[model samples]
Target: MMKRIVLCFLLIAFSTSVFSGVADDGAISTGEYDYGIIEWNSRNPSLVVEGGANVIDIRNYGRLEVRYTSIPINGDWYTGGIRDIHLDDYSELLYLDGITDILGIDENATAELKGGSINYIDSMQNTDTKHIDLYCQSGWSWLYDDEDLDGIDEIVGITGLWENDSAFTIGFINDYTFGYDPVYMNINVVEIPEPATLLLFGLGGLALRKRR
Candidate 1:
Protein backbone atom coordinates (compact mmCIF):
# COMPACT_ATOMS: atom_id res chain seq x y z
CA MET A 1 0.00 0.00 0.00
CA MET A 2 2.86 2.35 0.76
CA LYS A 3 4.47 1.51 -2.56
CA ARG A 4 1.22 2.24 -4.32
CA ILE A 5 0.94 5.61 -2.65
CA VAL A 6 4.55 6.45 -3.48
CA LEU A 7 4.11 5.53 -7.12
CA CYS A 8 0.93 7.53 -7.42
CA PHE A 9 2.66 10.68 -6.23
CA LEU A 10 5.70 9.84 -8.30
CA LEU A 11 3.60 9.66 -11.42
CA ILE A 12 2.10 13.04 -10.74
CA ALA A 13 5.51 14.56 -10.14
CA PHE A 14 7.06 12.93 -13.20
CA SER A 15 4.29 13.75 -15.66
CA THR A 16 5.99 16.96 -16.77
CA SER A 17 9.16 15.17 -17.86
CA VAL A 18 7.67 12.72 -20.35
CA PHE A 19 4.82 14.71 -21.84
CA SER A 20 3.45 18.26 -22.11
CA GLY A 21 4.66 21.77 -21.09
CA VAL A 22 7.13 24.47 -22.13
CA ALA A 23 10.81 24.06 -21.18
CA ASP A 24 14.10 25.99 -21.35
CA ASP A 25 15.59 26.74 -24.73
CA GLY A 26 19.16 27.04 -26.10
CA ALA A 27 21.68 25.54 -28.54
CA ILE A 28 24.97 23.77 -27.95
CA SER A 29 27.70 23.09 -30.47
CA THR A 30 30.55 22.92 -28.04
CA GLY A 31 30.96 22.79 -24.24
CA GLU A 32 29.79 20.28 -21.62
CA TYR A 33 26.50 20.61 -19.72
CA ASP A 34 25.76 18.46 -16.68
CA TYR A 35 22.77 19.93 -14.85
CA GLY A 36 19.57 21.94 -15.20
CA ILE A 37 16.49 21.66 -17.45
CA ILE A 38 17.52 21.84 -21.11
CA GLU A 39 14.72 21.81 -23.61
CA TRP A 40 17.19 23.16 -26.25
CA ASN A 41 13.98 24.56 -27.65
CA SER A 42 10.30 24.48 -26.86
CA ARG A 43 9.67 21.80 -29.45
CA ASN A 44 8.99 18.09 -29.51
CA PRO A 45 11.34 16.87 -32.20
CA SER A 46 10.39 13.72 -34.10
CA LEU A 47 12.69 11.67 -36.27
CA VAL A 48 12.11 11.29 -39.99
CA VAL A 49 11.64 7.88 -41.65
CA GLU A 50 15.02 8.13 -43.31
CA GLY A 51 16.74 8.51 -39.94
CA GLY A 52 19.04 11.20 -38.46
CA ALA A 53 17.16 14.41 -37.82
CA ASN A 54 18.58 17.11 -35.56
CA VAL A 55 17.40 19.31 -32.72
CA ILE A 56 20.20 18.91 -30.23
CA ASP A 57 23.19 18.34 -32.46
CA ILE A 58 26.33 17.12 -30.73
CA ARG A 59 29.41 17.37 -32.88
CA ASN A 60 33.03 18.56 -32.82
CA TYR A 61 33.73 17.19 -29.34
CA GLY A 62 30.55 18.56 -27.79
CA ARG A 63 29.34 16.57 -24.80
CA LEU A 64 25.98 16.42 -23.04
CA GLU A 65 25.64 14.58 -19.75
CA VAL A 66 21.99 13.74 -19.20
CA ARG A 67 22.39 12.51 -15.64
CA TYR A 68 19.45 14.58 -14.44
CA THR A 69 16.35 15.84 -16.24
CA SER A 70 17.80 17.29 -19.44
CA ILE A 71 14.98 17.11 -21.93
CA PRO A 72 11.89 18.49 -20.34
CA ILE A 73 8.54 17.14 -21.44
CA ASN A 74 7.41 20.04 -23.64
CA GLY A 75 5.92 21.56 -26.79
CA ASP A 76 4.76 24.99 -27.95
CA TRP A 77 2.17 26.75 -30.11
CA TYR A 78 4.47 26.28 -33.11
CA THR A 79 4.41 22.48 -32.72
CA GLY A 80 7.80 22.40 -31.03
CA GLY A 81 9.19 19.99 -28.46
CA ILE A 82 12.23 17.79 -28.15
CA ARG A 83 11.76 15.51 -31.15
CA ASP A 84 15.29 14.45 -32.10
CA ILE A 85 18.79 14.25 -30.59
CA HIS A 86 21.72 13.73 -32.90
CA LEU A 87 25.26 12.64 -32.08
CA ASP A 88 27.84 12.65 -34.80
CA ASP A 89 31.52 13.15 -35.56
CA TYR A 90 32.86 12.07 -32.19
CA SER A 91 30.37 13.98 -30.08
CA GLU A 92 28.93 12.42 -26.95
CA LEU A 93 25.55 12.06 -25.23
CA LEU A 94 25.65 10.17 -21.95
CA TYR A 95 22.17 9.56 -20.64
CA LEU A 96 21.57 8.51 -17.05
CA ASP A 97 17.94 9.52 -16.53
CA GLY A 98 15.39 11.29 -18.71
CA ILE A 99 12.71 10.59 -21.33
CA THR A 100 13.94 10.62 -24.93
CA ASP A 101 11.82 10.58 -28.04
CA ILE A 102 14.14 9.95 -31.01
CA LEU A 103 17.95 9.83 -31.33
CA GLY A 104 20.17 9.76 -34.38
CA ILE A 105 23.58 8.25 -33.80
CA ASP A 106 26.16 8.43 -36.53
CA GLU A 107 29.69 7.11 -37.00
CA ASN A 108 32.19 8.04 -34.30
CA ALA A 109 29.30 9.37 -32.18
CA THR A 110 28.63 8.27 -28.64
CA ALA A 111 25.09 7.93 -27.29
CA GLU A 112 25.02 5.78 -24.19
CA LEU A 113 21.56 5.15 -22.75
CA LYS A 114 21.99 4.26 -19.12
CA GLY A 115 19.43 5.05 -16.38
CA GLY A 116 16.18 6.45 -17.80
CA SER A 117 16.65 6.86 -21.51
CA ILE A 118 17.22 3.13 -21.87
CA ASN A 119 14.08 2.32 -23.78
CA TYR A 120 14.02 5.13 -26.34
CA ILE A 121 17.65 5.33 -27.55
CA ASP A 122 18.09 4.95 -31.27
CA SER A 123 21.27 4.22 -33.20
CA MET A 124 20.12 5.80 -36.40
CA GLN A 125 23.16 4.96 -38.51
CA ASN A 126 24.97 2.42 -36.36
CA THR A 127 22.86 -0.65 -36.92
CA ASP A 128 25.86 -2.88 -37.50
CA THR A 129 27.33 -2.55 -34.04
CA LYS A 130 25.82 -4.47 -31.16
CA HIS A 131 24.42 -2.32 -28.32
CA ILE A 132 25.14 -3.28 -24.75
CA ASP A 133 22.44 -2.99 -22.11
CA LEU A 134 24.33 -1.12 -19.41
CA TYR A 135 21.64 -1.16 -16.72
CA CYS A 136 19.19 -3.80 -15.58
CA GLN A 137 15.90 -1.94 -15.33
CA SER A 138 13.34 -3.84 -13.30
CA GLY A 139 9.61 -3.49 -12.53
CA TRP A 140 7.99 -1.70 -15.46
CA SER A 141 5.16 -2.40 -17.88
CA TRP A 142 5.17 -2.52 -21.66
CA LEU A 143 1.76 -2.44 -23.31
CA TYR A 144 0.53 -2.63 -26.86
CA ASP A 145 -1.15 0.40 -28.38
CA ASP A 146 -2.20 1.36 -31.88
CA GLU A 147 -3.94 4.62 -31.22
CA ASP A 148 -3.91 5.57 -34.88
CA LEU A 149 -6.13 2.55 -35.49
CA ASP A 150 -3.29 1.36 -37.70
CA GLY A 151 -1.77 -2.13 -37.51
CA ILE A 152 1.41 -1.09 -35.69
CA ASP A 153 1.96 -1.48 -31.98
CA GLU A 154 3.80 1.35 -30.23
CA ILE A 155 5.52 -0.87 -27.67
CA VAL A 156 8.12 -2.50 -29.86
CA GLY A 157 11.28 -3.30 -27.87
CA ILE A 158 13.22 -4.58 -30.84
CA THR A 159 16.11 -2.23 -31.60
CA GLY A 160 15.82 0.15 -34.57
CA LEU A 161 12.68 -1.61 -35.84
CA TRP A 162 10.41 1.28 -34.87
CA GLU A 163 12.98 4.01 -34.06
CA ASN A 164 11.61 4.22 -30.49
CA ASP A 165 12.42 0.69 -29.34
CA SER A 166 13.31 0.27 -25.70
CA ALA A 167 16.01 -2.34 -25.13
CA PHE A 168 15.44 -2.30 -21.37
CA THR A 169 12.64 -2.11 -18.81
CA ILE A 170 11.05 1.28 -18.01
CA GLY A 171 10.39 0.94 -14.27
CA PHE A 172 12.30 3.20 -11.90
CA ILE A 173 10.55 3.10 -8.55
CA ASN A 174 13.54 4.22 -6.50
CA ASP A 175 15.73 5.98 -9.04
CA TYR A 176 15.40 9.43 -7.59
CA THR A 177 17.10 10.73 -4.49
CA PHE A 178 14.62 13.57 -4.21
CA GLY A 179 10.82 13.55 -4.46
CA TYR A 180 10.80 15.30 -7.81
CA ASP A 181 12.11 12.79 -10.36
CA PRO A 182 11.73 13.94 -13.94
CA VAL A 183 12.43 10.67 -15.70
CA TYR A 184 9.35 8.57 -14.94
CA MET A 185 7.04 7.25 -17.60
CA ASN A 186 3.80 9.11 -18.20
CA ILE A 187 1.49 6.07 -17.81
CA ASN A 188 0.70 4.09 -14.71
CA VAL A 189 1.04 0.32 -14.58
CA VAL A 190 -1.33 -1.50 -12.29
CA GLU A 191 -1.04 -5.17 -13.23
CA ILE A 192 -0.51 -7.01 -16.46
CA PRO A 193 0.61 -10.58 -17.16
CA GLU A 194 3.64 -11.13 -19.27
CA PRO A 195 3.06 -12.67 -22.69
CA ALA A 196 4.78 -15.88 -21.72
CA THR A 197 2.80 -16.10 -18.51
CA LEU A 198 -0.40 -15.35 -20.40
CA LEU A 199 0.32 -18.29 -22.69
CA LEU A 200 0.13 -20.64 -19.69
CA PHE A 201 -2.88 -19.14 -17.96
CA GLY A 202 -4.68 -22.50 -17.61
CA LEU A 203 -7.66 -23.70 -19.60
CA GLY A 204 -10.02 -21.27 -17.86
CA GLY A 205 -10.48 -18.26 -20.13
CA LEU A 206 -11.28 -16.02 -17.20
CA ALA A 207 -8.30 -17.07 -15.15
CA LEU A 208 -5.98 -14.50 -16.66
CA ARG A 209 -6.59 -10.84 -17.46
CA LYS A 210 -4.95 -7.44 -17.83
CA ARG A 211 -5.81 -4.54 -15.55
CA ARG A 212 -4.21 -1.19 -16.33
Candidate 2:
Protein backbone atom coordinates (compact mmCIF):
# COMPACT_ATOMS: atom_id res chain seq x y z
CA MET A 1 0.00 0.00 0.00
CA MET A 2 2.79 2.44 0.85
CA LYS A 3 4.60 1.71 -2.41
CA ARG A 4 1.46 2.34 -4.42
CA ILE A 5 0.80 5.59 -2.64
CA VAL A 6 4.37 6.80 -3.16
CA LEU A 7 4.20 5.83 -6.83
CA CYS A 8 0.97 7.74 -7.31
CA PHE A 9 2.37 10.83 -5.64
CA LEU A 10 5.50 10.67 -7.76
CA LEU A 11 3.48 10.32 -10.92
CA ILE A 12 1.37 13.27 -10.04
CA ALA A 13 4.41 15.41 -9.27
CA PHE A 14 6.09 14.42 -12.53
CA SER A 15 2.99 15.20 -14.54
CA THR A 16 2.63 18.59 -12.93
CA SER A 17 6.27 19.44 -13.63
CA VAL A 18 5.95 18.41 -17.26
CA PHE A 19 2.91 20.58 -17.81
CA SER A 20 4.53 23.50 -16.05
CA GLY A 21 7.65 23.23 -18.17
CA VAL A 22 5.62 23.32 -21.34
CA ALA A 23 3.50 26.20 -20.12
CA ASP A 24 6.63 28.30 -19.44
CA ASP A 25 8.19 27.68 -22.85
CA GLY A 26 7.39 30.76 -24.94
CA ALA A 27 5.39 34.00 -24.97
CA ILE A 28 3.20 36.05 -27.35
CA SER A 29 2.26 39.73 -27.31
CA THR A 30 0.43 42.00 -29.77
CA GLY A 31 1.33 45.27 -28.10
CA GLU A 32 -1.18 47.91 -29.27
CA TYR A 33 -2.17 46.14 -32.50
CA ASP A 34 -5.07 43.76 -32.98
CA TYR A 35 -3.22 40.70 -34.24
CA GLY A 36 -4.60 37.30 -35.12
CA ILE A 37 -3.84 33.99 -33.45
CA ILE A 38 -0.79 32.97 -31.40
CA GLU A 39 -0.72 29.20 -31.32
CA TRP A 40 1.76 26.92 -29.55
CA ASN A 41 2.79 23.40 -30.44
CA SER A 42 5.27 21.23 -28.62
CA ARG A 43 7.06 20.59 -31.89
CA ASN A 44 6.29 23.82 -33.73
CA PRO A 45 4.85 27.18 -32.59
CA SER A 46 3.84 30.24 -34.60
CA LEU A 47 2.73 33.85 -34.26
CA VAL A 48 0.68 35.96 -36.66
CA VAL A 49 1.07 39.75 -36.50
CA GLU A 50 -1.34 41.77 -38.59
CA GLY A 51 -1.71 45.44 -39.55
CA GLY A 52 0.52 47.47 -37.24
CA ALA A 53 3.91 47.38 -35.59
CA ASN A 54 4.42 44.35 -33.35
CA VAL A 55 7.16 42.74 -31.32
CA ILE A 56 7.81 39.04 -30.50
CA ASP A 57 10.19 38.04 -27.73
CA ILE A 58 10.75 34.30 -27.43
CA ARG A 59 13.62 33.39 -25.16
CA ASN A 60 13.57 29.65 -25.84
CA TYR A 61 11.50 27.49 -28.18
CA GLY A 62 11.82 24.48 -30.47
CA ARG A 63 10.87 26.47 -33.55
CA LEU A 64 9.48 29.95 -34.16
CA GLU A 65 7.32 30.71 -37.18
CA VAL A 66 6.18 34.25 -37.83
CA ARG A 67 3.57 35.38 -40.37
CA TYR A 68 3.48 39.16 -40.69
CA THR A 69 0.71 40.84 -42.64
CA SER A 70 -0.26 44.44 -43.10
CA ILE A 71 -3.37 45.58 -44.93
CA PRO A 72 -4.79 49.00 -45.61
CA ILE A 73 -7.40 50.29 -43.17
CA ASN A 74 -10.60 51.44 -44.95
CA GLY A 75 -9.00 51.15 -48.41
CA ASP A 76 -5.95 53.11 -47.39
CA TRP A 77 -3.48 50.67 -48.88
CA TYR A 78 -0.72 53.25 -49.10
CA THR A 79 -0.22 54.12 -45.43
CA GLY A 80 -1.91 51.48 -43.25
CA GLY A 81 0.46 48.52 -43.53
CA ILE A 82 3.07 46.69 -41.49
CA ARG A 83 5.66 49.23 -40.54
CA ASP A 84 8.42 46.90 -39.27
CA ILE A 85 9.12 43.60 -37.43
CA HIS A 86 11.91 43.21 -34.90
CA LEU A 87 13.07 39.75 -33.76
CA ASP A 88 15.18 40.32 -30.69
CA ASP A 89 18.36 38.45 -29.65
CA TYR A 90 16.59 36.31 -27.04
CA SER A 91 15.70 33.70 -29.69
CA GLU A 92 18.85 31.63 -30.04
CA LEU A 93 19.61 28.62 -32.26
CA LEU A 94 16.63 29.34 -34.53
CA TYR A 95 15.84 27.22 -37.58
CA LEU A 96 13.50 27.76 -40.52
CA ASP A 97 11.85 24.82 -42.33
CA GLY A 98 9.84 26.29 -45.28
CA ILE A 99 8.22 29.52 -46.33
CA THR A 100 4.45 29.78 -46.67
CA ASP A 101 2.49 32.96 -47.35
CA ILE A 102 0.62 33.93 -44.18
CA LEU A 103 -1.00 37.24 -45.12
CA GLY A 104 -1.08 39.72 -47.99
CA ILE A 105 0.27 43.24 -47.90
CA ASP A 106 0.68 46.19 -50.24
CA GLU A 107 3.42 46.26 -52.87
CA ASN A 108 5.03 49.28 -51.26
CA ALA A 109 5.02 47.74 -47.79
CA THR A 110 8.25 46.49 -46.25
CA ALA A 111 9.29 44.11 -43.42
CA GLU A 112 12.55 43.83 -41.57
CA LEU A 113 14.24 40.75 -40.07
CA LYS A 114 16.17 41.72 -37.01
CA GLY A 115 18.21 39.67 -34.47
CA GLY A 116 18.49 35.87 -33.80
CA SER A 117 20.48 33.22 -35.69
CA ILE A 118 18.28 31.78 -38.43
CA ASN A 119 19.50 28.33 -39.45
CA TYR A 120 17.37 28.29 -42.58
CA ILE A 121 14.97 30.59 -44.51
CA ASP A 122 12.79 28.65 -46.94
CA SER A 123 10.83 31.03 -49.22
CA MET A 124 9.38 34.50 -49.40
CA GLN A 125 6.41 35.62 -51.44
CA ASN A 126 5.01 39.02 -52.58
CA THR A 127 8.04 40.79 -51.16
CA ASP A 128 9.71 43.51 -53.20
CA THR A 129 13.07 42.10 -54.25
CA LYS A 130 14.75 45.51 -54.16
CA HIS A 131 14.01 46.28 -50.50
CA ILE A 132 15.39 43.06 -49.02
CA ASP A 133 18.37 44.35 -47.07
CA LEU A 134 20.66 42.10 -44.96
CA TYR A 135 22.70 43.47 -42.11
CA CYS A 136 26.23 42.10 -41.89
CA GLN A 137 26.47 42.68 -38.15
CA SER A 138 23.42 40.48 -37.53
CA GLY A 139 25.05 37.21 -38.74
CA TRP A 140 22.87 36.79 -41.85
CA SER A 141 24.98 34.74 -44.25
CA TRP A 142 23.88 32.88 -47.36
CA LEU A 143 25.65 29.50 -47.41
CA TYR A 144 24.64 28.16 -50.81
CA ASP A 145 22.61 29.68 -53.64
CA ASP A 146 20.85 27.15 -55.90
CA GLU A 147 19.30 29.68 -58.24
CA ASP A 148 20.03 27.81 -61.51
CA LEU A 149 17.79 24.84 -60.66
CA ASP A 150 14.03 24.86 -61.24
CA GLY A 151 12.81 23.43 -57.93
CA ILE A 152 12.90 25.20 -54.54
CA ASP A 153 15.96 27.39 -54.24
CA GLU A 154 18.25 26.39 -51.37
CA ILE A 155 20.11 29.23 -49.65
CA VAL A 156 21.97 27.20 -47.04
CA GLY A 157 24.86 28.31 -44.87
CA ILE A 158 26.30 27.85 -41.38
CA THR A 159 27.26 31.40 -40.52
CA GLY A 160 24.72 34.20 -40.45
CA LEU A 161 24.90 37.57 -42.27
CA TRP A 162 27.49 39.03 -39.87
CA GLU A 163 30.68 37.75 -38.28
CA ASN A 164 30.91 36.80 -34.58
CA ASP A 165 27.33 37.88 -33.93
CA SER A 166 24.60 35.24 -33.99
CA ALA A 167 21.66 37.49 -34.84
CA PHE A 168 20.88 39.20 -38.17
CA THR A 169 18.57 41.80 -39.71
CA ILE A 170 17.21 41.91 -43.25
CA GLY A 171 14.55 44.04 -44.92
CA PHE A 172 12.43 43.05 -47.92
CA ILE A 173 9.36 44.20 -49.87
CA ASN A 174 6.16 42.35 -50.72
CA ASP A 175 5.46 42.09 -54.47
CA TYR A 176 3.55 38.87 -55.14
CA THR A 177 -0.16 39.00 -56.08
CA PHE A 178 -1.41 35.53 -57.03
CA GLY A 179 -1.07 32.42 -54.82
CA TYR A 180 2.12 33.70 -53.27
CA ASP A 181 0.72 36.84 -51.66
CA PRO A 182 1.84 36.68 -48.01
CA VAL A 183 5.13 36.57 -46.10
CA TYR A 184 5.91 33.29 -44.33
CA MET A 185 8.89 32.45 -42.13
CA ASN A 186 10.05 29.19 -40.50
CA ILE A 187 12.45 29.20 -37.55
CA ASN A 188 14.09 26.21 -35.85
CA VAL A 189 15.87 26.03 -32.52
CA VAL A 190 18.14 23.21 -31.37
CA GLU A 191 18.22 22.63 -27.63
CA ILE A 192 21.41 21.32 -26.02
CA PRO A 193 20.96 19.71 -22.65
CA GLU A 194 23.35 20.55 -19.87
CA PRO A 195 25.50 17.80 -18.43
CA ALA A 196 24.33 18.33 -14.86
CA THR A 197 20.69 18.16 -15.84
CA LEU A 198 21.24 14.98 -17.81
CA LEU A 199 23.05 13.34 -14.91
CA LEU A 200 20.29 14.26 -12.49
CA PHE A 201 17.64 12.80 -14.79
CA GLY A 202 19.60 9.56 -15.14
CA LEU A 203 20.01 9.23 -11.39
CA GLY A 204 16.35 9.93 -10.83
CA GLY A 205 15.36 7.25 -13.31
CA LEU A 206 17.61 4.73 -11.66
CA ALA A 207 16.19 5.52 -8.26
CA LEU A 208 12.64 5.09 -9.53
CA ARG A 209 13.47 1.74 -11.13
CA LYS A 210 15.06 0.47 -7.94
CA ARG A 211 12.08 1.57 -5.92
CA ARG A 212 9.70 -0.25 -8.25
lDDT of 2 by residue, 105-140 (tens): 222322334333332232333333422222334223
Model 1 regions more than 4 Å off:
1-54, 70-82, 117-119, 126-128, 131-133, 137-155, 158-212
- Model 1 local distance difference test score: 0.40
Index of the highest-lDDT prediction: 1
TM-score of every candidate relative to the true structure? 0.36, 0.25
lDDT of each: 0.40, 0.35
Error of 1 at 112 (Å): 1.9
- The backbone clash count of each candidate, in order, is 12, 24
Best by TM-score: 1
